[model samples]
Target chain A: MDTRERLIESTRELLWERGYVGTSPKAIQARSGAGQGSMYHHFHGKPDLALAAISRSAEELRDRAEAAFTSSGTVSERVAAYLRREREALKGCPVGRLTQDPDVMADPDLRAPIEETFAWLTGRLAGLLAEGRTSGELHAGLDPAATATALVAVLQGGYVLARAAGSAEVYAQAVDGALGLLACHARQEPSRPA
Target chain B: MDTRERLIESTRELLWERGYVGTSPKAIQARSGAGQGSMYHHFHGKPDLALAAISRSAEELRDRAEAAFTSSGTVSERVAAYLRREREALKGCPVGRLTQDPDVMADPDLRAPIEETFAWLTGRLAGLLAEGRTSGELHAGLDPAATATALVAVLQGGYVLARAAGSAEVYAQAVDGALGLLACHARQEPSRPA
Candidate 1:
């Protein structure tokens, strides 16, 4: 891979593992085998390089979510796919995880991509939920935006719980319980025999 | 306060602000006004000092959480009190926030207090939930342990959302929404004329 590409990937990996505050430009250079001149030539500095990495990770998460959100299925299926999509649940979301990072949180420039990523996720989920309501697939009582926020909180919080306990079981259970609750609200009965 | 005590308190602050890997001994010494010799005398190293500070934080969180959990009221009221308790929601829970630190997570000794604090919280919440159940205050369908885990996640994850958005509004909404959902199954109806 090119130095630019390698630098971005290395920064992304370091950010995911050590967070923005914990990551350093020298470390990035070492991980990518890209010299300081090459690194600076491609990007201005740590903030600039980090912005690129954060934006890329944000896009990756959105794309991954879209894979499930756009699939041919009920809202429940799509939501379930969205939650259970082969996640490193214990490691947490590459972008959402950055929110806890103090350095990342302090910089609007760095935080924008992270913030927009979640806002976009919740917006997409809310849109799907709105569709579900119109199709009589969800309770009219359910507030799409609020429910979407709650759903995202559950996933993010589930990672905290799972990681604290050093087991993905807690994360899985929460997802299962949430999916079950959503499934029980199914509108149309399957024509197939029970 | 003594320099040793000051050193620890300062570390707790720094750790909360910068996390384990991000914080340095020199920073701690400067913040505490303890010379390098004094700090070394009191702490085996930065890791030792962090363990002490983290354990101290874990205890504080437990004490703080217990205050709300044991307050007088019905299940929803108690849970609400626990959720609505004075929080630097933007600052987040010192103990809970530590879970996001990779160095802390990578160290079992560092992580034990965190795990224990959450374990105690969930266990305590479970007991309260079980009490509610035994008194015919909860739906037969809800699992106390699972529900408790969900509650903790909602708070932890809520912080994530709020901090990312730079607004406590989303966190409050998630808590209120979850409480409303839980109230749906409460033995005593919520907001009835009393």
Candidate 2:
């Protein structure tokens, strides 16, 4: 890969591991094997490179979620599949973890991708849920928009709990709980006419 | 406040604002208005001071939640009240924020308070939910342990969404959605005899 690609990839890894505040330009250079000159040649500085990295991560997150949402399944099954997707639970989310970084959140330019990513995710999920309701698969009482937000939050919060306990099991339990609650909203099918 | 008290408070504020990686001894000392000699005299180092601050924050979180849980009302009412409690949503939860700090999570001593706080919170919430089930206030099908984990996760994840969007409304929506889903589990009262 070229120096620019290497730098972006390295920044993404470092940002995931150490966050923005703890990740330094020097470390990024070392990780990517790109000198100061090459880094400057590719991007203006840490902020510029971080923006690229963050944007890439956000796009990837959206792509992954889209795949999960669009996969062949009922709404409940798809939602369950998304929650149960394999993740580096102990490492936390690449994009979600950035929300905790003060430097990242304080800058409007840096914060935009994170904001857009979540908005897109929740909106997509809400659309899928509304589809489910229209198909009579989900109870009519289930509020699509609100339920979408809650579902996303549960996955995000599950990471926080898993990291706190240093155990992936906590994350699994949280997802299971969310799934069980959602199961309560499943519409019972009427018997077919003879 | 005494010197030690001031130092802990300052550390708490800094930790919340900047996280462990960004929080430095010099910054803490400056914020607390305690000199180098005074700081060293009072505590071992940054880690020592951070532990004290984290423990204090954890204790306060538990105390606040306990008050919310014990308030006079049904289980659903108490849960709703807890979710609806006033908060600096954009600023995020003091204890939950630390889970994203690599430095804090890397060390057992620093991570202990965070682990204990969530455990205590989930345990307490589960107990309340179980009581609700026993009283027939909640559906018998409800799983207390998993529901408690999901509830706590929604709150933690709600902060993530709010911070990402730079809006407290997102957080409120997430909480509202969780509450709505939870309401599905509320048992109905039996009809009164004439």
Candidate 3:
């Protein structure tokens, strides 16, 4: 890969581990095997490099989220596909991880892509829930918007719980609990015959 | 406070913002306003100071959590109260924030106190849920342990979502979504047993 590709790739890795505050231009240079002039020549500075890296990461996350949303399945099936999608549970979400970065958390320019990605993900999820409701797979009373937000929160929070506990098992259990609760809202048939 | 107290307090504040990876002994000395000799005289190194700081933050979080649990209210009431507990939102959870700290996440010593704090919190929340179940205030089917973990996860993830969005409003929406879902389990017994 070229210098720009190498730089963004290394940054995604560094940001995942060191966070925005901890990851520096020097660190990126070292990781990318690129010199000072090479880094600055390719990008203005840290913020510029970070903005590119974040946008790349956001695109990757969006692609994965879209795959989950568009995969062949019922709405409930698709939702489960998204939740049950294989993940490095302990490592957690790379883009979501950026949210905890003090520098990223502070800078609006740096934070926007991460924010928009989640907003779109949850919005798409709400749409999926709408599909479920229309198909009579879910109860009408269930709030799609609220359920979508809770779904994302549970997964994000699951990572915190799992990491703090030093196991991915806890994260899985939490996700399962949320899904189980959602299952209760699956259309409960009354005595009426169609 | 004395030099030692100053050092610990500074470490706590620095750790919350910059995290263990970004925080250095030199930085600690500067922030604490304690000279090298005084800092060394008070503590051995960063590890020593970090342990003290993590433990202190853990105790404070627990005390704060207990206040919400012990407040006069039903289970849902108590849970909502706990969810509504005033938070900086942007600064994030002092203890939960550590999970993202590379240095703290790397060293078992620093991670231990954070782990134990969340463990204690989830356990206390489980007890509250169990109490609610027995008192007919909560759904008997709800798993207290899992629910407790999910509740804590919502708060942690809410901070992440909100911060990423650069708005506490999204965080509040996510929490409201989770709380509203849980509220569905609140007892809805009809009056007049004719």
Give the poorly placed runs of model 3, Cα more than 4 Å off: A134-136, A189-194, B187-194
Ranking by TM-score: 2, 1, 3
Name model 1 segments beyond 4 Å from true. Answer: A180-194, B187-194
Residues B41-122, candidate 2: write the lDDT tens digits.
9999999999999999999999999999999899998988888888899999999999999999999999999999999999
Query: Between 2 and 3, whose TM-score is larger?
Result: 2
Error of 2 at B54 (Å): 0.2
| Candidate 1 per-residue lDDT over residues B1-194, each given as its tens digit | 99889999999999888888789999999899999999999999998999999999988889888889888988767988997776777877688778789989999999999888888898898788778878888755556776677777778888888888888888886676566446545655433111
Q: Model 2: runs farther than 4 Å from truth?
A: A189-194, B189-194
TM per candidate = 0.91, 0.96, 0.91
Between prediction 1 and prediction 2, the one with superior lDDT is 2
lDDT of each: 0.81, 0.92, 0.83
Which window of 10 residues has the lowest lDDT sum in candidate 1 chain B?
Answer: B185-194
Return the top candidate by DockQ: 2
List the RMSD of every prediction in angstroms.
3.4, 3.9, 4.2
Error of 2 at B150 (Å): 0.7
Over the stretch A49-97, how does candidate 3's per-residue lDDT look in tens digits? 9999899989998898899999998787788888878777788778888
Winner by TM-score: 2
lDDT at B120 for candidate 2? Answer: 94
